[model samples]
Target: MTGWLDRAAENAHKFAQRNPRAVAAGVMFSLAGFAATAFGVASPSAPGTEIAQQIISEDVQPLPVHEQLEALAAHQLELNRSTAGRANDTADRLLSRLGVNDASAASFLRRERGVRDLLDGRVPRLFTARADESGRLKELVVRMPAERRDQITTHFTRVTLHPAGHGGWKVRREQAQLESQVRLGSGTVRNSLFTATDEAGLPDTIATQLSEMFSEEVDFHREIKKGDTFSVAYETLTADGEPITWNEGAGHLLAAEYINRGRVYQGMWVRDAMGRGAYVGMDGQPKQRSFLASPMEFSRVTSGFAMRMHPILQTMRAHQGVDYGAPVGTPVRTVGSGVVDFAGWRNGFGNVVEIQHDGDRSTLYAHLSRIDVRKGEHVEQGTRIGAVGATGWATGPHLHFEFRIRGVHQDPLQVAKATQTPMASVSRAELQQLATSARTQIAAARSMGAVRAE
Candidate 1:
């Protein structure tokens, strides 16, 4: 067998060498045939049988649409900017401070009769002025108190000074409408009344109104503890057909309630037969007393009304009034409606004000930097009387407030509480109408998140 295999191999090798090209061609053809058979078994369609073709479409243009431009005036798009300033004593000084460069407008306003009356007032009038691009005073407006010879309408004056095309201004005086809207808000005191009200989106002016409304009843500074809550419905002015900003032209507190430390204090605003508004309770009793508990809006009782060692004199003495430690220039207000019996420097009190209220009642404010009222001047309740200071016999800036009756000094806080009058419920017929109206308004307000602007 071995001899036969060897003879066969030798013969094959010899044959391969003689026909190498034919041998290589035969091997390639065998591999190609095997691959083709394997691929052909899995093929879905036979190649070169018939290739399918699809039709191609040409593009077309879109349809046209017509349009036109709207016309707008250049001046209409431009806004007239203004700056507000308080008028000084003289017209020249006020014009200088207000940056009014127009000599013609200045001369016209100075010569105008209405302008002079509007400018001259006990308190400096607030004026708003506007100038054109060339720095010429184009308009000047001052909101003055309306002078009504006969009518009892709630109105004000909008005195406008503008160009008349005759090289001077035409002074126009128009009746300004003092429109008002009722607004509502409720808040819980977490840190402070101001903080909570601010968080509730209430204005500071309204917050001040709330404090004043409940001033005689609530001790907002001390008695107002955590978890105390309050709700208020008040009027906000819409002045001269313009929207009232948060700080400008704040109206009065219409109604309010303060729930403090297991006690509830309520106030409602109502107009009497004479159309005079007063804050009362739901039962129709006056919420306001003869005097407010405190004269300073925001203060701390650093030194109570008692015997204490005088800081400056270094001696034991009776501190007849409460000493509220505050920064200088804090506003001091009158506790009640009264006349300014005295507003000047005293022996120990710096800029002192003595207001004599009804029924021989009086209140004293001392240690003031500046006095705002003069002697014999009638001031309303909560009117600013002076600014806090360290005037007179004091070591630092504070308000020494005292409540006196018939020339006898008493504890201000105690006097405030004692002055509260017993509230009497209104008649059933009258109560039904007022309560229904109030409830309806409050419910409407509660359902809304904010006051709707007109």
Candidate 2:
């Protein structure tokens, strides 16, 4: 113990022996003061009046206020911007909108191999161009807003077009100088899919995309029940240079998920190790199936494949095809890539278009009023082969669709569901890596109302 503390303790011992209660109280108070001092607390040793009498006070004057001179800011120059019209699918129209009067430049842009997609109908855009007084475009900037997760441009990428030497034009790509924002949307399925998505303030296009994404796992047409919920995480585009962007609608839907009757399905756009993108599942499986959805865009199934009493024949027989009732001359589409096997008449089947697809599978479309494809000609999926009609086997106007595996008939509904192919291994792994972001997006989508990204 310190010498001062020891002396104090000795004095306290003496006080304790004389009056223990007074000593105990004084010890507690002393300990409290000691503790306060230890904690850097200012313990006043003298009374307020004594301290005030011994202290002096003084005040300093404030610094003099001064006016500072500053230079005026310059105004930003606005780019001359114009929109490509609906009929602007051609290079002439595109150059015209950009105020380019040069005919050779227009022809160059039209015939250039690399610029076809920029000039296509799918990505029609407004142009920000620098033109001369004579109406010759010195430079052109076209904004390509990201539309899909696997797309080339992530944010707002620009395609800058300019004149090259030798009276020719060249194109250069500009990185995304624009900002991208994330947003959320959520809703539970109630009466209909559109109603539920609309209630969540989601775009109809996004809802449709979500349905197509999850079609392999959930049947949106019949399996969707009440209380099933869906959520989406998407992006919006903006720019510092242009306050008003030509981009419309929500951009790429980065991630989406669904909880249908206690089962969960998620889809996230993931870029593989090779930098290729695909929508994948949590288990690293490629989930999207590219197939012709339905032969008839809109129709009612008047007759299905089953054994029934034939309308023309008296005896009950096996009905080998599904009949879709439509108008007299509705366009029928080929469901898959194949060669036309027989685009001619049969005994019971009228004008038929039989397609020989891979894996010994063939699709037959019968009762067509007219045929557009010739036998032995290759026809891609979604090709207009013929029009639906009642040409043979006495009946009303209906499309007789049949799916055959090695000549054995299979149900059309089952065929459609079995056609989905898993993506490659690289894409699957790439998609799995995006699980973390995808899950976070789903959470955001579930928690918030529709929020646009800035």
Could you say which candidate leads in TM-score?
A: 1
Top candidate (lDDT):
2
Residues 45-129 of candidate 1: C-alpha lDDT, one tens digit per residue:
2222111000000000001100000122234223243333343455666666666667777676678775676556453245667
TM-score of 1: 0.43
Instruction: List TM-score per model, in order.
Output: 0.43, 0.38
What lDDT tens digits, residue by residue, belong to model 2 across residues 289-385? 5356468888888777676789988789878878899997899999988789999898778989999875456899998999999999998888999
Off by over 4 Å in 1: 1-83, 86-140, 145-155, 174-177, 198-205, 215-218, 243-250, 261-266, 285-362, 365-431, 444-454
Q: Which residue pairs does candidate 1 place in steric collision?
A: none
Candidate 2 wrongly placed segments (more than 4 Å): 1-77, 80-82, 86-123, 131-138, 142-185, 188-190, 195-206, 225-227, 234-254, 261-264, 269-280, 285-432, 450-454
Report the alpha-carbon TM-score of model 2 versus the true structure.
0.38
Worst 10 residues of 2 by lDDT: 32-41
How close is each model in CA RMSD to the real structure?
A: 36.5, 26.7
